[model samples]
Target: MRTPLDSPFSPGSDTVPQVWAGRTAQLSDWRDVVRPRRLAGLPERGRTILGEAGLGKSSLVRKIAADAARRGDWVTPQLRIPSGTDPLKRVAVALLDVARQAHLATSREKRIGTLLDRVEAVAAAGVSLTLREQQGPEPYSTLTELLVEIGRAAIRRGDVMVLIHIDEVQNIASEDALSQLLVALGDALTHEEDVEVPGGMLIARTLPLAVYLTGLPEFADMAGARKGATFARRFRTTTLGPLGDDDLASALQPFLVEGWEISDDREGATRVFMEPEARAAIVDLSRGEPFLFQLAGEQAWYAGTGDVITRDQVIRGWGGVRSEAAAHVERILARLPSREREFLEEMAGLEPADRTLTTIARKMGLRRGSDAGPTSQRLDSVRGIITRGKPYAFRHRAVEAYLTTYWPDPPAGDAERESTSAEGIG
Candidate 1:
């Protein structure tokens, strides 16, 4: 008999799960679109992944970076968006750190040495500028210089690719900083130069850098609104959400396909399989949201009794973690703007089959459904908090359940209101 496996699910923020699923379009875009464009020296291209928190935006980007690393690309550490004056200093540090690990020929070593000095100088300048004292060269200027040079050297080598993955892009505070970094990236990407190759002088793209960015849709929308369409249109935008039923099942059954690894140091942490009934039960409990899916999977593993997970075990596991799942949903709600939450509350107050824009408007005491159109659209597009339909729906059933539990029930209809007023004191 085989031992039961440890919890292979990742329930935390930005952590990649053992079983990957439902990202065929995104994964293909990275490989087919970005990878091919980069290799062919076509126009600059990459992906900007925008979604609500816990939709695995960061995790998706990390997965891409990991794939690049496996393909022997020169990859940088995951850099979070910078705050202010020390903008992109993290970029320098991450790039240089990875580059330092390379063992190259003497000439290439000297070239890398020069790049390292520029990176250090850029980092120092940013630090100095942060302290309100400019000692070295300007941070933004030198940052641009260093990144371009790094990209150029990589292209000259003609061996490996360079990938920079950024997380928490919503935290970017400085417009000037963002604009400057974009400028540097644009310059590097569009650079055309004749370099000495093994055979002869041939025109080549100077820098072959690919970027993958992850952040909240709210921030992406706000930045684009503030900084113009360039910020939004810089990359192929992908909006993420919870996995669908089929995809969720795929996520649960990763090991069945072979070559998938689950590494854990715990006793009885080898392998396990779920009955279809059990997998469906877990999926229903998850409400198609990833955080809950992961949380439930994690708890299911802990509460699991045998090598084969049964529906009863899935139920027992979820029973242990339902409260935690509710709290997670509440946190998601608490983070939303007041209007968005109010909209959700209005929707939740109604029956699931009656959750239309008009019903939501009525619950919110608005005169016409059109009055709520913009807000509804914002909620749907910005973070996918609510989806649109004849009878609208939330991104997850758990969210609707959470809202209904706390918010007041829908108010009396027009007929009820008229009936009550007419009969008063009569």
Candidate 2:
């Protein structure tokens, strides 16, 4: 009897997998750039990660928050962007969740302590109005005061940093709301005030506080492209793309070494192997979108027998999981802006073998293929919809499959061009 252990792969959106493959660049930015700057008491800008759905944006944020929280010197409060409610109140609650994480309650700094207590009281009570009444009329203005005061208090105790993270930023109330938020963060970031230490010595220091945002690529135009210098000076947007071939291989390697447990006896480890063909199938199917890696891996694990996950097993897994995979592709495309979606649809209508940059440009109704080059590359790099291959194609095979299945029929003369071998996606 095959002892079936539950699937080890984490397949849900924003679910950090056991292996946690790829994202070297994002980690580097946090480590080399943000971490050092905050440690040195140097001012740092907010990091905004933008990508399509299933690109691991939220997972990356949560990973970083977990890292920061473990540092013992940083207070990391993470929140998902709110809709139909007071967004600032949601933020207030996130802050209150970690209020005890900072050393703000000390008796030495009465003013800072009192400030912390006031914020703690209002935020803990969940009285949105009470929190707002003490500060400026604008919620952002009130937020600025809260961040600056709390960050100052934290830094005064010891060199500490405050990292505020908000995910699903595209859902933030409105453009005006985001603009105000940027202004508020900019104000708090630049706030350098007199700090009284235990010995009554005062020092002027900038609050070691930074914000991190993640959402769809459109969010760049929302918060990253504000009308003023605040966005440019104090914030940066990093567009996340798919994992490479190596990341696919690396994610599956652990199963081999650890021996996927397959028997009722938990102590005895089954000798599990992932063939090169199995890895290739994963690379081809996932094409680097983070969630697909997990999903495909999960399916492959379930379909395999004995010890090894062979290419045939992987293909069978894909066949079994194709409908769900296509659903994921559909949802991602459904969430994209119309122009972005249309570009993908135009490409999907082409014969997969003919999906060159020039062909895509012409298909997009552009006069010259060169006109589409930058946009195509940007779509690949910024949004990860297209591949960086010579003949540019949908990055994920399921993208082509989704579009091919639902795209409108071609004109009479173009029927030959209409049919795509999207069958391989399964």
Candidate 3:
């Protein structure tokens, strides 16, 4: 057999994972919430998926979108709210794409032809329209109108839904823009409520538009801060943490058994990817983070030769895993203010087990006042890098190991320093 080379694990840089494990409950729950018709007495609230970096927020959204599209119940156009971009204009263009797709999907007569024509006219005007120059039938209004029209068409033709999947929603810098978007969605639903078709045609009483957004915890907080709690309350927020041990194992199993099948002497040809010891070590190294699982798996896959991957190969692969994860650490640390970086470096010196804020404060030689509370908050602002629990620790073991290289030398009597002097990846 070939090296069983093609990877089934998706680092999610290019493709989604072939075998998605965990998140089944979340998928089902959200699907029902956003399903075509509004449930009796259940409001159509916006859905927000929140998590730290590398927790597969975007991947989960993509999976949901793909499933919805496959059923022909929804037309999902994925959009990203990139930093500093005009979210309104971006949404406008994205809705236009949705309209085009709807146009292609339905026949000429039943199609929302009038709305599609208006969308084209607005889009042809270019995305450079100023707020003052384009006040009447504005971008927000146009989008809402288009969505309601689409919903009306869907109701006429079975029970289709239109869901827009937006990622990195935290990057939308304008709080006003976020508020406007929620309003647009609200307006879309309201408009669909009283539409009476000219030719005695009937439309669904509920709007079929749903917006799903995903971003880091900090961004979610920022959005909430920008808009008041009432505005934030409009979204049904779901926070996802790292996977559990069983779920992590389930996620990795497919990659091994299917992607890297091995030949066993006793069993002829069996699909066992890693030795038991190797699997245990990789799981430990992963520390429940999804991206780390992919990174470690990618390294271990190429580290071994022939059928089974041994514990030794996994151990060796860990060296490369640590290095790659450290690069990520370096990038995150670079973005931190100097004070936060200093706080992390100080935290790194203590034995990994003794990294609580109380202990960390003592080590920094603080008397009455300590920067622990604020500094720890700053560190966690990077999201998922530092786990701010009872005993503070790097979210991943590999991150802790990488930080060991940067620990400052100990004074003669100090007990915290554990690593030799070296230029840490500053």
For every model shown, what is its TM-score relative to the native structure?
Answer: 0.81, 0.77, 0.75
Tens digits of per-residue lDDT, candidate 3, 247-329, equal 87776675456645545545565454667766776676666667777766666666655456655555555565566665655
Alpha-carbon runs more than 4 Å astray in model 3: 12-14, 36-41, 104-118, 121-135, 174-179, 189-205, 254-272, 337-426
TM-score of candidate 2 on Cα atoms, chains taken together: 0.77
Candidate 3, residue 2: Cα displacement in angstroms equals 3.3
lDDT of 2: 0.68
Clashes of 1: 0
Lowest-lDDT window of 10 residues in candidate 3? Answer: 416-425
Q: Lowest lDDT 10-mer window, candidate 1?
A: 406-415
Per-residue CA lDDT of model 2 for 1-426, tens digit only, reads: 122365667888565567588898888888788877765567777888988778888899788777777776565556777664445556666665445555444437676565555555545433344444665255565567677666765766665668888878778755665666677777887777776756999877677776788888877666645645668787777877667778777777766566555544655545666777677777777757678778777777777555777666566666667677777777987877666677788787888788887887787888897887667766786676778586666765456645775311112323332122224433
In model 2, the runs with Cα more than 4 Å from the true position are: 1-6, 103-137, 157-159, 193-205, 225-228, 257-271, 337-339, 348-426
Q: Give the distance in Å from residue 177's predicted Cα in candidate 3 to where it truly belongs.
A: 4.2
